[model samples]
Target: MFFATTALALLIERFIGYPDILVRTIGHPVQWIGAFIAWLDARLNPESEPGNRLAGMLALLALLVVTGGLALAVALALRKLPYGWVAEAIIATPFLAQKSLAGHVRAVADGLDRSLAEGRSAVSRIVGRDPEQLDRSGVARAALESLGENASDGIVAPAFWLALLGLPGIALYKAINTADSMIGHRSPRYLAFGWAAARLDDLVNLPCARLTGLLFALAAYFSSRTSAKAAFAAMRRDAHRHVSPNAGWPESALAGALGVKLGGPRAYGGRHVDLATMGDGKSELDANDIRDGLSLYGDALSLLAVIAVLLALAF
Candidate 1:
């Protein structure tokens, strides 16, 4: 039953995605979670507090209680309805984001064909870095990197949790993730207060990130444009190079698969961030590379669906 629910949600999200009208009408679940986090931050995360870390821990506990409880209530209520699994699947659909992620990444490639300024504008929407500082290669690399990282965060991780513990599982994961995105930074304001959110997000993402990397390697094995061996090897060799314990896995895999160097120095908010490079390949990235990355991403999703089906059949 869990497997069927996961597979159905994945397929539905892949084809139709979350509707824009629905998003505009009620906003996303993540946004709702973010609102709660914001409220907590304002009340509990003041910089002057001596016990900032303790406060952060308490805030995280509160968030978990609320999100997990709400999800459980929803799941239980849906079970009472006709075709309850279908209702559950519908509730789970917005959590996974395969089509939306691919579409946004593809838009960057499309924008690049028009002009460099347009390309920067498009990539800026998805990435956190300053777009004005990015050159043509930088913009393409940023888009591809976002694709790899979000493939884990937005798609694989959610599906993984949903398969394991149903609707409540995915809801819990997203709440942790949203907290990490909002407050889990190394900046002075967040360094202490956001510790629990950042660490917990990393812990949950660990397995899913590796799974996503392996799926990408499998996708490369079936593709003529990439080398599967190199992709896997690169992931093993360089996945730890990033500051993030999890993001490097998929990013390194995609870099080696596409024969492109990623993860060099980039700017975020007027500050230059010098990071380790992933692949020992060409650094000249362009629109075509972005298209190829998207294709590889699609192949990875297909492999994920097959795995979900197999798991369903087996368990």
Candidate 2:
């Protein structure tokens, strides 16, 4: 049941994606989760505290209970209806983002095809660093890095949780991720207050991050242009060098597969982050590299779907 629900939801999201109209109408689930997190942040998070840590933990607890409870309620209600698993799958579609990730990455390449300025503009929409600071290669690298990291965060992790625990599992995972995005910062304001959220996000992402990397490696193995050996070597050698415990796996895998270097100096919120480079390849990436990265992403996404379907059949 879990595997079938996951497979159905992935297939549905792969085709239609969550529409902007739907997002604009009521708002996306992540936005809703963000709103609730904000409320908790305001009420529970004090400016100064020997209590912010406890407060943050309480906020996280509340978020999990509410999110899981509501999703479980909806799943139960839908199950009472005919073809309820189908309905659950539809409801779960918005949580997984395969098509949209590809779209964003493709838009970077499209923008670069027009002009460098337009490329910077398009990449800015998806990345956090100042777009004005990036050259052509920087823009391409940013897009690929975003594609790699978000593949795990936005799609694989949620799907993993969904297959493990159905609707409530996926919902809980998203809640954690959204909270981490909103409050799990290293900034002074969020530092102590967001400790629990950040740590928990890391814990939950463990399995899926590595899984996403392996999937990308398999994708590379199947492709003539990319190198599976490089991907695997990078994972073993450079993945741990990344600041993020989870993000490095896919980012390094994709970097090696594409034969491009990723991760270096970047500015964010006026602060410079001296990040370690992932792949021992050429740093001069162009728009075409971004397209190649998207091809790799598509292959990985297909592999994930195939795995889910096979698991469904096996169990």
Q: Mind giving the per-residue lDDT tens digits that candidate 2 earns over 195-234?
A: 9999999999999999999999989988899999999999
lDDT (10s digit) by residue, model 1, range 80-165? 88788788888998889999899899999999999999999999999999999999999999999999999999999999999989
- Locate the minimum summed-lDDT window of 10 residues in model 2: 45-54
- Per-candidate TM-scores read 0.97, 0.97
Clashing pairs in 2: none
User: Which residue runs does candidate 2 get wrong by more than 4 Å?
Assistant: 46-51
Worst 10 contiguous positions by lDDT, candidate 1:
45-54
Cα shift from native, residue 194, model 1 (Å): 0.4
Name the TM-score of candidate 2. Answer: 0.97
